[model samples]
Target: MTTTYRVTLRNRNGVPLDVAEDEPIYAAALRAGIQLPIACNYGGCITCAAKLITGHVRQPKGTALNRRQSQAGFILLCVARPTCDCVLDVGVESHRGLYQNPFAIAGNRYPPDA
Candidate 1:
């Protein structure tokens, strides 16, 4: 059976996104038109790392984050799955003009159907 969790993230703009069930948190942000700075789509790079303000996350592969960071509530969007309804605060500084563009969109943006 497939598992899912609701995820909420606080962006640099202080905007929060309520992502639906079963989707990776990063994927959910992308769907919400939020571009999380990421280098590798995999867990190798920690660039997409974000701080978990509340809730649980499961990282089976554990590639995106080191032990210390994970223990400190840091999660790599590339490999993080919410174990419960969770909230995260973005770690990186968002590009100023990027979000202004209606064009700078997520590569694999697909939101759940209403």
Candidate 2:
């Protein structure tokens, strides 16, 4: 049987994507072009941390996570799976300044089809 999950995220831009029962949330986001920030794909890193505003998550087997963080509503999407309809508060405040930069990125001038 196939497992389908309901994922509601922070903003309209943060549309939820589909994830297979066994697939990692990070992998699912990547497949859907969500560009979720992640460094180590393993639980060793907290770069992909997101807040589960609602619902439950099932972590991978043998993974280690701090109970305090869990209680505080933090989740590492790189290794998390929803056990019910979920809403996540993504994009941490630490990275908010980056989004405010208007001149930070200079896109390619040449046309890709040229």
The candidate maximizing TM-score is: 2
Q: Count the backbone clashes (under 3 Å) in each candidate.
A: 1, 0
Runs of candidate 1 with Cα error greater than 4 angstroms are 1-4, 11-21, 93-114
lDDT of each: 0.63, 0.66
Candidate 1: residue 28 Cα off by (Å): 0.9
lDDT tens readout by residue for model 1, 6-88? 66655555565555445567877887887787778676777777888788876555585545455566777767777777777
Candidate 2 lDDT tens digits, 10-114? 654558776766667777778877777787887777777777778888777414345545556677888888777788777664232212232533463222211
User: For every model shown, what is its TM-score relative to the native structure?
Assistant: 0.66, 0.71
C-alpha lDDT (0 to 100) for residue 85 of candidate 2: 72
Q: State the TM-score for model 1.
A: 0.66
